[model samples]
Target: MELHDRRQAPWHDDSFEGEMVAVMTVGVPGGEVLLETSRLLLRPWRVDEAVVQRELWTERDPRVPPHRRIDEDGHPTVAELEDSIRTHKVWSTGLLAVERKASRDVIGYCGLVDSGRGATGEPELAFELLRRVWRQGYATEASLAVVGWARSSGYERLWATVWDWNTASRRVLAKVGFIETDRKEVDAVHGTTLFTTRPL
Candidate 1:
């Protein structure tokens, strides 16, 4: 798909707020249905997209803090992305690829993961977008769609953590109706992190 200006695209809508909608296709075995938002597609990661995943890990915007960007060893090699795909397959929920509908370019990933932080089995929402797409509403838009899907799948609640200094991501979580919880944790990688949640 050719990339287009999402802001002016005609397919954008707010219907995700009311129901769980999907594109009528089978997703990864045991995963949730494929999801589509006004400007994006949320689906299982394809093996062919490993190169894109590597790019996201290696080419992040310079403004991203060291802890958030690629590790000292540099970008994840294609072999690593392939291994990650196998791991995502076993997740109770997806770590779906976020693709621009207009261009079909894989941007990043968003979905739920089992958290070990508070309650051991709580599901946590997670997302990361390509740096080039920063400041756009894609993160918020994709998250709302994921939340809708999670609710339909019978999840009662979702959790997330954002580094204190990553204010931009915090705002995206807030926009999607996530409220900060009274929990904070210290991480070796991210320092102090704030926890947030949204009830399904």
Candidate 2:
């Protein structure tokens, strides 16, 4: 998938214009920073983990819409994963791998992204864990950290989108203080998408 260009300012609602200007002045973080939670460590993508990241793309849950899964051809090639890592490296505050503190295993990725789906161009929180790790509260835990990081980074607000069928994700957003917004969109594969947001 094509990544959002981090060089551009995130979109925001009209009421947030002043806050958005303030965020732009502060700018993005300059380097990777480790975020620690009770049971996980969130850190930058590593080149050696390309294969692990590719498995994540290809092994999504069956409930996920086709368009959100890996391409029909198969798992992303190693080269593709490397390219993705390179793109992620460009954004100082982009996605990071979630490592379980107990096993030291990388289970998934969670972080912020600039999204146009809301037409607000603001940063959107995103996360996906391996199917094996579902229902373990990892998503909510990692998300809380990301939200806290955004607030401390000078963002005025953050946004997110969830497929209507993704009740689990919706709950996770709620746990992290995101409220459903009036904005919605329909996609050919993912069906109806609900937008949500929270102030930083």
lDDT of 2 by residue, 1-200 (tens): 12223223432222221221111212334545456676877777777777777778777666577665787686477787887777756323478788898999889898887766543535889998888899998898888777766665666788999988888999999987899988888776656889998987
Clashing pairs in 2: 10-121, 11-120, 11-121, 11-122
Off by over 4 Å in 1: 1-14, 17-32, 59-75, 90-93, 118-121, 187-189
lDDT (Cα, tens digit) per residue for candidate 1, span 1-200: 00111012122234665542344233335533467876888877877788878887787555556764678686467887777776656222367788898987988988776656645445788898888898888898889887866665556778998877788889999998899988887766546789998887
Show the colliding residue pairs in model 1.
Answer: 1-103, 2-103
List lDDT for all candidates, in order: 0.71, 0.71
TM-score list, all predictions: 0.77, 0.77
